[model samples]
Target: MGQTVNLKQRLAYNYLRDGSTKFLCYGGAGGGGKSWLGCEWLMQCCYFLPGTRWFAGRNNLKDSRASISVTFGKVAQWHGFTGYRLTNDGIEFDNGSEIIFLDLTYYPVKDPLYERFGSLEFTGGWIEEGGQVNGLAFSVLQTRIGRHLNDKYGIPGKILITCNPKKNWLYDLFYKPWKEGTLEDGYAFVQALVQDNPFATEDYIETLRNTNDKVTKERLYFGNWEYDDDPAVLCDYDAICDLFTNEHVKPSGVSSGSADLAMKGRDRFVAGHWKGNVCYIKLDQGYSTGKSIETDLKRMMIECSIPRSMMIADSDGLGNYLESYLNGIKEFHGGKQPINPEFDNLKSECGFKLAELINNRQIRVVCTDAQRERIKKELSVLKQDHIDADTRRKGIISKEKMKEILGFSPDYLDMLIMAMYFRIKPVPKRPKAKLGDI
Candidate 1:
């Protein structure tokens, strides 16, 4: 007997089956049969596309076994497909097609570039709980697929992601763009809520309805993307997203540039040229040596007519190497005292100023989709540190903490924040009155 799927799952299958669509996001809420659809799709493909390889990935292997693997078992039994058996790592079929299970957790120190999967070759894959995976991991996974038996089978390589509402990369890469009708070609998003799933348990539905957590209810029950609210958040998500479309931020003022050169550990070198508040990214690539960045940056400045007197680069780590060559360029040290006494340090002051400029729609960024997504991911982590402690000086969260949360260095946001150095004015001190004058 053939397995049955709801209309929403069927719609996702349509995208998966299409030759044009390469990436697909199936669901946005619980009980939408996301796992079932993903498992069944991979299973059927394993049988149909003989000699092909596939992967089923999640945040961890244990979660994949407990959730996605269990769902695969049920889906297999329901269809009465007995041609496959579970192995130590994954499922292997009689036709030689295999479905490998993978742990897609983001560990910066161990596998910042996800090079562990560098040699992997797969025809397609599914990422369950896609929101839990980091953007860089997903990006690397995309490259690994479409390398196994695709030409032999006459099928396009596809990667399906199943997720609930989350304000991570999925939101920036899918939901927001889908809402704006600007999602790129070859990518598709199909949102399905609990109500759309007919097989959902009544008890589970009732539990979701009865939950007291407003954010959880809104996310799981209604699939709302805008329900999240955190006190420490310095800028609104919408405002951060609007930075790319702020056409009113005219480019009429001083021409300047900012660069954040990576010292090491999988961080990239990022540089941007600016005309007043409008930023135009010139370079964003992995660092091999300071020579390449220095050459590229000098070219950009010369091309943009930006002088070394107006250019700024962080004087930390490898940035010093770039600065040593480009003499007369302004240097920005994050640990130095802030021009504004209210901020804890130079970095904190600029971070807050960047957030203000974003929220006030005073900044505009011109870049490609990949760059835009990276910028959004970086700035989304800009939040106040010690928001509740009145005794502490006002400061944004530290780079180490941001790295922990983002799974990588926030080079883009750091460069953008460093650009605020030009915007900050030194606060004047009041002079003491003379006795005779008084």
Candidate 2:
């Protein structure tokens, strides 16, 4: 006799029953039993179909080992498939179906993994953290599911995805598709929250509730994706554009610069040059090597006709490497350090300054289609909460807000925020008094 299933598990089972369901997504609050449902559903697929091959993946291999593999191990044991071999990152079943565990962290490049894995023609798959995988990566994985067609295994295969809502790029790929009712073409989505599971202990649910911060509480529990009651946004797109067009704005007289450093895979460098309140963007979307970034910077400097000291570069994460490289160049060639401040701190200070400038009618932005779209999609999402409720109450809604309202992720808008942040004034310094004149 099979073990009795829970309500959430039954929903997942029903979705799996319709072999036509190409994609199955279950997401929302934590402790919703989404992971458990996913494990049991995958196991059942492997059990019922001979020669069926499935892959279960997460954001990282370590997580795959600890969560997906471990959970599936217990489920397999309960379901009488005890002799399966749990290897480095996979579980092999007795009847030739295998559950291979993979991670996105191992492969950041979006398309290559698809080319490599898509060749295998997997019968089915599951993405554990649907929120983390890039849309391109998820799309690539989806292509790999249609090689075999047996009566037992069904046709077109299927993919099971599980996630909690996060305001990242993946929102458009999975959440929006299903939420908008367009998923009927190739997918079916089901929302599961902690409150939906009866077996989940009240204490556990309350614990999650207690531990969740204000943002998490809003996003996870209530599924509210609005601007958290925080204040940090300095300018609203509508206001910026309005002020610029109405002539109630001042030009900062400072130019803007953006930098993209090369990483492990393909690198596309972009920078925008602004002067007297006009922006001219330059894009370099091609192969860039580690040795060529300096050359690229020099070319950008020439194009903008700005001294090396005036340009600002992103120096967080891989950006640190670029910073170190520029510092090395200063020591060897220029005999002075280039001004590349810590991106995050600089961004905050710039945001604050921009807010002040906007409040005083000292700055203007052109409402160009590119600029408006970028602000609506990117800058709108970059706000941090203000401590005072009254203060936080003002300004445009955040990306999370837009996601709840619009049902899509904002990536291009984020890049626009970075561009704006790069142009903010350097940290204020104490003014020097004239020598001997107090």
Candidate 3:
């Protein structure tokens, strides 16, 4: 006999079978029978829709081949499905339907770049561990759907993602919007905890319940959205997430801001808008260039109504060009004397003060949860050391060292430091304009 269908899976498949929704996200926690559902859905689709093509995979090919592919074959056999053979591509049905198993990862791009998918076409596909994939990858995959072997198939191409609770793009793209009742018309999110699944093992459920980490317990068992694990995290997760509610409503006056041009690998150009104390990030994601970022920064200033003079950007050769364009920007160099004597330089001082704001609960950041995670990760990984010669001085980790820890530069957090830099550092008064000529 085939695997039993749970109520949650039944409802989710009904939505997928209707052909009304383009995207279906099912299951929020582990042991929700999600993988079983994936196997059943793909089999049914291939059997019903003749000559259609589909893809299924996770982040690792070895894992997908060793497990996902094997599971599908077993489930198909149990259902009395016949005349299908498994290959490297997928299981090919006699009707010409195929499910291509794959493994997608970031490889070279800091974020997974879907360049491999540029030429491939498909009817629809399922992502096993959806939380592990980035949003841009999904965007790329969506475009390729609805293009192949779908002409005869009455069902419009649909993408299904089975994943546990994660605070990445999935949260903002599906979970958060679903919670707020703002999910788009053609998309659906199905919430499923372990208890909701009929197939969950008693021991497995017990393990999840007994997890020592609060974040792991909330996520793997209950599918909670607000939890993370990071060492030395300056900003509290609750403190940052709470700013979204209507509890704190300050006037929309932006006092100062920051700009981070693409410096090295994995770093995107960013423009941060600071209102009171919260920082809103705007980035140049698609196009990466000096001129492009120059335009993005100027646009942010006008949009936020921040005076051009109050913003600071790193003083590189490109930054000098941007300085000429804005005419109202500060050139930041970390070598400048710190506002605090204990810190070695401007960058270290800025980092110290930013941490103070976060640890003290004095700052609220207006950023997407995913962006907030990036910032939090960077801050938490940064280690502070004490200098030997100067007993009062506190030394910040070098960029080279931080890169070793994080595998990339902390571009966003750097921009945030610049955003908060102006607040604590005293601006020297303009030199006395005693005119020798006037």
Model 2 pairs in collision: 225-400, 226-401, 230-385, 230-386, 231-385, 231-386, 377-413, 378-413, 378-414
Query: What are the per-residue Cα lDDT tens digits for candidate 3 across 139-164?
Result: 78898898886776666889999988
- Best-performing candidate as measured by TM-score: 3
Q: Candidate 1, which ten residues in sequence have the lowest lDDT sum? A: 314-323
Q: How do the residues 1-438 of candidate 1 rate in per-residue lDDT, one tens digit apiece? A: 376989998899899999999999878887888988999999999988888899999999888767777888899899988898887688899999999989898787888788999999999999999878887877998898889989887888899999988777788789989999999998999999989899999999999999997767888898987655456878877798899999988998779999887633368888999999999999888744667778888999999989898899873666566668998888888989998889899999999999999999999999999888778878878999999999888999989878866667898998999999999888888899899988
Per-residue lDDT tens digits for candidate 2, residues 359-388, read 455544554565454444444454644435
TM-score of each: 0.63, 0.59, 0.65
- Clash-forming residue pairs, model 3: none
Q: What's each prediction's clash count? A: 0, 9, 0
Give the least accurate 10-residue stretch of model 3, judged by summed lDDT: 242-251
Clashes of 2: 9
Q: What is the lDDT of candidate 3?
A: 0.75
* Winner on lDDT (1 vs 3): 1
**Candidate 2, lDDT over the whole model:** 0.59
